[model samples]
Target: MPESLMMAFSWLDWLALGWFFACWAWYYEYSRRRQRSKRCLAGVMHGYRYDWMRRLLGREARIADATIMTHLERNGAFFASSTLLILAALFGLMGTTERALLVLADLPFAASSPSRLGLELKLLLLIGLFIYAFFTFTWSMRQYNFCAILIGSAPAADEKDSTPGLRKMFAIQAANVIDLAANQFNYGLRAYYFGLALLAWFLHPLAFILATAGVVGVLFRREFHSKTLKALAAGRDLDITFRGILQHEETTSESLKSQNK
Candidate 1:
């Protein structure tokens, strides 16, 4: 490569690194606010909001009663979006490290006679990253399909009074939401990982490692160390159970007092 071209490439690489960090920081802050809200809300309210949030994020954007067309539409949208993202990440990997290694072998380095070992290492890493991206994308797609199925099969309001079907539907929807949320979380983590790899194209590989560690640390905090997880794990369910009992007691007391009066 010419001196000017190499310098330009170097500058572009640094810019990409800066952009990656900026985006990651923004997401980190956003995730923090979300976690804080989860911690502050009561169990009933949290459960309610969890359902609402799932619907809001869903592609269908509305609850429907077991419609085939709706399921197909939502699934198609989810698959399309996830597939595109996966393809983009794969393209980036191919255009960067894989291509760079190809060029590097032709240059004069200490062990530069084809460097078959280094080439194989680069190929393996690229393949692994591609697989990660594919899995994240595909799993999110599958979860969205599950969400579609849940929404489609939900019973009508009229049936709520006559059967336990409605409750079962809501429970299924809740499980689907959990699956969607978990997969979405994984997808976000994969995005940060890919961003780190992109940064590695410009900065030292150590920068990639640091970025990965930072992303993982943030995930760990949210998943295990955060107040939200602690609250949810410790007493949220108990509080909910207690609240139900208290409501029942209050209703009974009020009924007895009214009867005496």
Candidate 2:
């Protein structure tokens, strides 16, 4: 591209966008690996979820498992609806982007009014994030449905007892399905978290950078150092443990209890 086209926005704007993506990717990879071995929130919950399913082998009534899955599916459904609405609103802005750019041009800290192409690219970036979230959320819903099916199909304790090692295999498999669904849902929610930082771009590139840093800091603290992680770890009985960032099934269980009462 020629300098004329490139100069439609300041170098700062491009740098800020680049920096945000860099940080986003770094945090994702770091948290993913750390979750495997560390006592992070997600890892700990995985332990509990596994134990929960494992214990169900001995139970005749599995109302608790159904309620837990319902809560999770509801959570995913809410985000899926949100993403669809946001994407619709974003696309509606496409025709009026120039006018929005006009408004942006009047802002006190505006760098340079970007070209029509530039604004369209930014809009596409936002749309893309929401689209990703939508798929992730819906997929999570499907996975939760699969989890319910797995729970329903579980063999009775006496049946498993006769099979020696079969109970452990069944428990691990069931927990793995549930954990994978929750993981995708977390990724969708993380996109929303990063999307807030991206919104600062509409204000100013400097604001964008600061917002990205702030959001990342908040996320890092919640994932690695939050009191929630400690609480979950404290609640650990049996072999359950934790590792990182995301929360676990205890909240669902509590919510279920509240609703029942």
Candidate 3:
């Protein structure tokens, strides 16, 4: 880069910004690997998704499954729309950057402020983060649409042409599609979390670094050791019980049909 462009930030500021991005990337990679081999939230939820798809294959009525998929797609759509609004607001903020800097300067404990150019660069970085989030959210929505189609095409329980192995394969493939969609949604949400941490950059580079680390720590705890994870893990472990419940439901449905006939 040109020296003129580099003049906006000190060496320490550059180091802090580097550390912020490094932490985000490092934690993302770590979580991805850990989830594959451990009982993290992602892993647990994937097992549930597998079960959901398997159960879906045996059911004649799929209103509940379709409704569940609709909810998931809505979540992705909501975030995608929100990201656009946030991007618009950030762009508008660029117009008032000088006034914003003046307000920051008046604060008693505020550290040495960045140049207007540096402030604009930071805002641009935030805009970039949300842009990535928006893309992920939209992609996730598309994947959920694929999952819906998979559900619609699933073999019926009494299909003479469909073997047990074929149905099982279909369930696994459908579950995997849903899992990929969910992972994309997670990535988008993670971007939002890290973007919030980047806001501390306006105050001080050290604050930015600390905030970034804090976000990573919070994410680690929630994904690995939270009460929600424990609940899901317990549910995952009760596979036999869940299967029995499904069987009971199937028997009850048959009984009701017979009574109506």
Candidate 4:
């Protein structure tokens, strides 16, 4: 490669790498916060009586409420915005705009002979972006469909006559819907971040690999060590505690009433 070409490629490569790392950090932090909030909320719902947890993390947990419509709105916005950004990036990568502007202004990069290596790199990035976009959109659509089912089926009538199994089923469905929505949002956001990294690759191929690694690192933290995961586990514990307490209270009340009578 010519010295100038090499320099251009090197600069782009570094930019892509930096972007990838930055995105990874962003996601890691977000997931950590989310996990913490989830745990605190779970504690509150299950009557864990953790005043400090509530004081420090209550708002976050509230944000994670499985039924919150805001979560849905956020997901929708992410999908929409990501779709637009990705489309723009794709068009830019295709040089369509550059070609159109050729009549108006002479741009040096636009006029240079296309490099086989550069063209191949661009193609690879395009394919990756397309795959990520498709998966993110499709998954989000499926989650939205699941949410619709949940909205339609959720309890509207008195449950006095409903069997335990029926109630359990409803709870399961609700949980499933929440899980699906969360996953879709996570995947979609990651795709958007990756698209940015792909754009960075217009500068260099190594940048793409760096960005990929950074993203992977963030994902690892979220999946394994994030506060959100801890909170989720804690929430389960709180649920059991609350159920036990409720059962005990009912039993004690029944006995006391029988004796009084």
Better of 1 and 3 by TM-score: 3
Model 3: worst 10 consecutive residues (lDDT sum)? 106-115
In model 3, pairs of residues that clash are none
Q: Following a full C-alpha superposition, what root-mean-square deviation does model 4 have from the true structure? A: 9.4
lDDT of 2 by residue, 171-242 (tens): 899988988999999999999999999888888889999999999999989887899988887787433335
lDDT of all predictions: 0.52, 0.86, 0.90, 0.56
Candidate 1 lDDT by residue in tens digits, 78-191: 644664666576566564665666666554431233234334444454555545555665565566566566556554444536355546456645554644545454554556
| Candidate 3 lDDT over residue span 1-261, tens digit each | 988669988887898889988998899898888865447998888778888998888899998999999999999999999999999999999999999889889876556765898889989999999999999999999999999999889998789999989988888889889989999999999999999899988888888888999999999999998999988888777876788899999999999999999
Clashes of 4: 9
Off by over 4 Å in 1: 1-120, 160-181, 184-188, 194-209, 225-250, 257-261
Per-residue C-alpha lDDT of model 4 across residues 25-79, encoded as one tens digit per residue: 7765765466434343322232332332222222333323334444565566567
Q: Which stretches of candidate 2 lie over 4 Å from their true place?
A: 1-5, 160-162, 237-261
Native-to-model Cα distance after best TM-score fit, residue 25 in candidate 1, in Å: 24
**Arranged by TM-score, best first:** 3, 2, 4, 1
lDDT of 2 at 248: 57
Q: At residue 230, give the lDDT of candidate 3.
A: 86
Candidate number with the higher TM-score (2 or 3): 3
